[model samples]
Target: MSSPLPLVFDAPKRGLPPRHLADLTLAERTEAVAALGEKPFRAKQLSRHYFARLNVDPAQMTDIPAAARERLATELMPQLLTEVRSVECDDGATRKTLWRAHDGTLLESVLMRYPDRATLCISSQAGCGMACPFCATGQGGLQRNLSTAEIVDQVRSAAAVMRDGVLPGPDGKPAPGRLSNVVFMGMGEPLANYKRVVAAVRRITDPTPSGLGISQRSVTVSTVGLAPAIRKLADEGLQVRLAVSLHTPDDELRDTLVPVNNRWSIDEVLQAAKYYIDRTSRRVSIEYALIRDVNDQPWRADLLAKRLREHLGYLVHVNVIPLNPTPGSKWDASPKDVEREFVRRVNEGGVTCTVRDTRGQEIAAACGQLAAEN
Candidate 1:
């Protein structure tokens, strides 16, 4: 294995702007309200407006007394994300929003509409520390981990977008729907921002007015093979799906492709994944980005299947993603023939594998591309 990387470079820059309602648990919010000289129940009211009603405007909160409403809103509903710009493609069904944080940090989140459901891809950190060469976000390096509120508000905003019928439907007309799936596959390695990401997940899956009320099963958290973090997440008692970005089956290529691989080998990562499956009884997702003539060989596919079968057996699935080449990147998606053959080999080796339906390519949908371009 490569020598362990120095720890100084990867430690997240701590802290966020003033606390917001989404940043606190119910008990914390109650204490915050009391500290501001308001009754404890006012916290519940604020949570209902921000979470269930998805309204942050004090004026819209008619249930609260007018005087206290403004103070409460001003104190706990601080705007965390400002829209820098939004770009859309797939006939406006896919929208990517670039947001500027209070500290001038830039991050991107994508809301994609499909026939059966709407999925929002959220960022856990401002930029990625994983340093995956093919990813645009990793190119910029990690700026800072997002606050829990910063992460939760993305889902809330996207939920309102879906609820209010902003995106067009199958008939190419606006139709209201519920945002169903939330994927932590944008801009950052979620496990690198572990504490806030876990808190955000709770705020997302908890029942409203405590949270956005999205089901735990609908949430997916992806990491670039953070082995210890994977097992740590399993112990949290959450059923959210775990996705490992195992770009290659072999460590030689993976260490270059996913720099984090040097810290935790494939065996260690798979062993951690098996622990997650054993804990949650949910199938762990093995994410593989198929770069042309690189990590796309039939032998690699067979080896990936064999390793997965050996470690995880029926508790894992492979998601073969076509490489979304970043600007001026040497990496590109494999030819259809090569991708198809790769999938066939993995399936033949006894693990289920499927090519992901990639979207928003025309609009630079790959993770940090939009934020980087803007």
Candidate 2:
């Protein structure tokens, strides 16, 4: 067991984002519309345009009267994210967007187009508070927690781009498709921005006209061993998969690699993961970044497998990611032979494991590469 979490996790909130339609629930939208001297039905009309139709510009909302469009849209749908620039790789199959918020905060999101489905990796915070030395975002330190609207707007923008064929499909040509997966694996330790992240998840998984209508099962939330937050998320009746970024199995190295481990031991983290499985009945994912000899040792592989089996049994899957080196970082990915042996030892020890298919390294869109730099 580990000691209680320290109270110094959250960074100071610099500025609160302006209110937007994505921030409010269905009932709140109606109340706001009535308060603005508009008919209650206007709320549903505005929501359907923004959520279902992916239209945020008031000019395109022809359903509403010309006289009322500006007021209703301006008050409810203020633009939250403005595209700074986008870089693409993999024959246009992967696109990373740099966005500037209203307060000039920079954050990044990546959209990858696969043969069958598209997945968007969205950031839950402007930068990270976790202070993991190997990660680019963590090295920059946390800017602030994003508002619920800022988080959800990233998903909304990705869905719109996918629908509009902005990113090329498998054949190197533009083809419209639907976004099927969302991952909270960019820019931040999601659990540190707990409330807004949970609200954004609800808005993403809720029904059409109220949300983007994505399945809860298709979404994933990743953290670096925030044990109490893990338990809090499990009780929320959500089906989203929990991904723990446990780069190492032992506390000695993990305390330096993942700074949060100093607060919560590996045992406490896995125990919290076990509680999550008990509540959601979902297999938790263990994310291990294999960085050369630092954490790719054969003995650590066995220890990882043993620890997972003792706590989670079959309710766990391990995803070993080859470390994506950031600029000027000493960390390098483990050699292919070493990575293979590590996978072999883990599976031999009874826990199934696979290497992640890395993408967008050329444009710095790969795992742990997002710094949201200008």
TM-score of each predicted structure versus truth: 0.98, 0.97
Q: Which candidate leads in lDDT?
A: 1
Per-model C-alpha RMSD = 1.2, 1.7
lDDT tens digits, residues 149-220, model 1? Answer: 999999999999999999998788999999999999998889988999999999999999889999999999
- What does candidate 1 score in Cα RMSD to the true structure? 1.2
Q: Please identify model 2 stretches exceeding 4 Å from their true place.
A: 1-8, 367-372
Evaluated against the true structure, the overall lDDT of model 2 is 0.90
TM-score between model 1 and native: 0.98
For model 1, the run of ten residues with the poorest summed lDDT: 6-15
Candidate 1 regions off by >4 Å? Answer: 6-15
lDDT of 1: 0.92
